[model samples]
Target: LKVTIAQIDIPCSFGPAYEGERVRGKDLFVQAGGGKTQCTEYLELADMKEIDDGKVTVIGPDIPDMKRGEVFPLGIFVQVGGREFQKDFEPILERQTHHLVNYIQGVMHAGQRDIAWVRISDAAVDKGFTLKDLGVVLHAKLHQDFSAILDKIQVTIYTKKEDVDKLTAKARAAYKYRDERVDKMTDDDVETFYSCTLCQSFAPNHVCTVSPERTGLCGAYNWMDCKAAYQINPTGPNQPIEKGECLDPKLGQWKGVNEFVSKASRGAVTHYNFYSLVQDPMTTCGCCEAIAAMLPGCNGVMTVHREYTGETPCGMKFTTLAGVMGGGASSPGFVGHSKYNITQRKFLVGDGGLLRMVWMPKSLKEEIRERLLKRGAEMGCPDLIDRIADETVGVTEEEIMPFLKEKKHPALDMEPIVG
Candidate 1:
């Protein structure tokens, strides 16, 4: 493992100073994902014998080939191979892309996995920024930061729509495999939940208490991933937090967690609930995979995913909802959560769990239909997926009420959502 820490070779200035900068529409050259086009990212551990270090490949157009404002597809495939690299380390390295991509002076990265959205600014294009520069940045920084555990890095960028689609499908399968690692475990199974402040740069006061079932809001780091991260760098953003006496089992609040949240949030937030969105929910960040909002008129809640650009039953579009709560504030009646957490056993159980999900974007609902069906059976609502309304049924609670009542959506018959 004699990897040399090389200065990142790119035309643009890069560092953490530019991470908070945004590429407004006026400066946007071209973008990917963000509900406009498909963007997927994935990292896997490979055999050292199979991959070459510092190798970067691009499958389609570079930055110059596209005109301004054209949305394009992108797939970032990174392979890290080393004698000490274990499969468990893949996610830990993969998540670094969120902030690492933002390290560039004019680049903006949001979301994660198949929902990734990236923007390249006109200034970056003037500086000769290319798709391959993405590869270069990842290769250099990953090795420099994790060289103790990282040996060789290989990156492949796909700009072709077909290629990006293929990668998206493949990445989704990998994401499912990673998410299931904690399926059988419950929050009650552990006394300590790990804390992930990795996204704090984007949402300075935000802190995620990662339990076995509650994956990080970005849908990237789960409890198992954070555990491995702490092992790699004890002083890093991921830290273990002992769960002190339970103050409220239904809302999932703990004394130790409250204390840690206060200190970690710099006293900006003193406490939050893990299982109830109607109460003081966890602080939200900009890149959450989905945002759940209360549907006051429907006696349930509705969530919109990052990839859906349509109006939700809650009246606000996904982007509007994100902009309002993405700033690391614990907004009651709304919460940021991973899409996987939707089907988890304890997901807002205090607020009626999946049985209370009244609306979702059509694509998101269909994408998770199979899982929803399985979870629905457990909740004794075997056809709950069919009962949930989408944009097709209507994006307003009034328009969806007749539909929910007609379909016998369990939420309509459940206890009132608002006290």
Candidate 2:
């Protein structure tokens, strides 16, 4: 069996009619004029026959299967006598039919308008028809007309099976390439700057700026992706980080970052200082992502992640300490007093250190402790491994100190301890 497909255009109209029940014995009369009839005459012309025994199916406006404003195929099917007929029929059809040619032209034009597209799925070769013969019938009558339409429209075609496979492979390769590129960013790969315009919804006067080396306290976009996205759409939601000038290298302070923060935060962040934990310096916050409250009397920093009930040093209730900390100029590294305290030794030495009680949800607490222990070991502060790894709630200073000692860590020996 040989199959051929063609596309055609049609016009249609519609009207509404109501049906009524016939009265008793009298003959019922129905009005048929409400329905439409073709007022114009249809012109027909004899076209060439590709195969001697082929049957032509003309699809026009008269066809009930045609949908309003939709395009459909005027199909043709042919049964060849044998292999010779299969091989020879297509060439004969090409020399004969103008119907196929016109159909192809109409389809191509419609397709270019992004209106209608079509696909033909038939294996003529398996059905005892020569591909060359089929190709000729398609090419002479359809392919050439479709190509003409291509000149006036934007249409793409995949003829060979291998071509479709190649396209699929290429798409997969592109996605893989993108994924790998994103996965390669390290902590030091690129510097990130973050600002939360989103927070403006709740805190009209607040803006949170984040850096590349660290994540936003709220844990939004990382530095690299954030920077890349900003570069992609500068006028979009996320703006690029414009590095101004180096303020202090040892402390990672920059003039541009400070200016941006002050402007974005609406002067909420005025005095931007880096390093030297004290003396009119250090990062300040309105509300922080997590608050590492320092108990001066206890000489320890208590880290409250979020959704924890407790009294903070600043005496503020926190849902997420990060909510307050998310957009600050300070680094997440400086969570506890060890990072910002004037007397670092007070928190860094002996039984009393910056991090004392880590008040976090059970899940987050475990994650933080595990991560800190690993980082501490890498920093050669093995003593901190046990000190921060074990749970801190309800543990007395004495018990905490023994754990610190067990980890072979030394106590604070600063010259002047600050309250």
Candidate 3:
């Protein structure tokens, strides 16, 4: 970390430890994004001649000019040019905006891509901190951390409504293009999958082997995300795991995955089946956003999010299910996964894929309803969405069974899940 910040004068204390501190509404000096306005952060590769080196542009009012507790639309756009930079690394650098900005004292950062939310504390603003300091921190930190690949860094902060709206459209387009590219890719297209041990700091035995269809349990890092992380830091938590052999394509059991997990988990978890929760399922760290549980009565699986407080048809709440399934234990009848992963073609493919999903929290169902409907249609079960039960339908297996039978759910007709 060759961070040289001699030119910029920082007014307040700043570090990683302060990230957990909260800035409640009463204490906040301003809020950006958080559904109040269009907020986006974008990083792009450009020709060296195209940008003014080391320049920071603010297109609207400075921080001091705004009233306290005000809301504003913001856009952070960074363009870098260097011989070593690649287009694939753009999103990788872009993702760092969350952490780098959060390092500023009295500032909080959350979310990524187009839905970034940030807050400034009154304490820092009173100490002379301004929006321009945000750009300075980004410029200095990016140059310091990514100097090997970034020869020149230029940032433009847009606070004006028209400017933010225009930049957000471009940012959203880039986001969609990257997502589609990763979504269309398959495991066969790549020779290696990535292993993420980020959670190993807490759960020592946890290892996440991310593929094209599967993402990190936190629902943040996808295959492309891990790929870029590996390129950025070869010795970091993310590394490539070669796909040695196809042990079971339907179950997504691989020789290399087994070998890596055995070594990473210190032999605690030696066997893993990707698509079936009833077999030797993948172990999870407690950080997973959701858990998939087996519902024997309906011969299907029910997914419950960590935020969901209600019980599921599986007879367990999210907390009970996570406690049973997490801590890097190879437990059949339970698995951990990202919410976005449910729509993938490989999701529980060994146990009938999307058709195996019978129950999920209503909020989660609504969050993923569009994707679920599209996947249902693709699986030749366009009516599957309505057939799947939610909290409103019933929470217990017996309570939901009648509804399943009434809807003629395919899982009711499928083979017994608990053999």
- Tens digits of per-residue lDDT for model 2 on 152-210? 11112222334434433543343233223334343234454545443343344444444
Q: Give the residue spans of candidate 2 off by over 4 A.
A: 1-194, 271-289, 298-300, 310-317, 320-363, 389-419
Residues 1-419, model 1: lDDT tens digits = 46776688999999999999999999999999888898899999888887889999999998889999999999999999888888988888988898899999899998888888899999999999998999999999998889888888999999999999898888888899999998999999999899999888888899999999798988898899999999998999999999899999999999999999999999999999999899999999997989999997999999999878888888799889999999999999999999989998899998989899999988888888888999999999899899999999998999999999999888888889898
Query: What would you estimate as the lDDT of candidate 2?
Result: 0.33
The most accurate candidate by lDDT is 1
Q: Alpha-carbon error at 22 in model 1, in Å?
A: 0.5
- Report the C-alpha displacement of residue 247, candidate 3, in angstroms: 6.1
Worst lDDT 10-window in candidate 1: 1-10
lDDT of 3 by residue, 1-419 (tens): 23355544578777666655667888899988865677778889989899776688999977887988788999999998878888888877886786677777788876565667789999889899887777777788778777778888889999999999899899877865665667888878888999988666446788989899887766667898889889888987789999789999988899998999899989888879888888888787665668898888788889997668777777788778777776778778888887778888888888888898888888888877888899999998998889999999899888888988999888988888877
Q: Where is model 2 poorest over a 10-residue stretch in terms of lDDT? A: 32-41
Spell out the clash pairs found in candidate 1.
none
lDDT of model 1 at position 139:
96
Worst lDDT window (10 residues) for model 3?
Answer: 1-10
lDDT accuracy of residue 212 in candidate 2: 39
**Global lDDT of each candidate:** 0.91, 0.33, 0.81
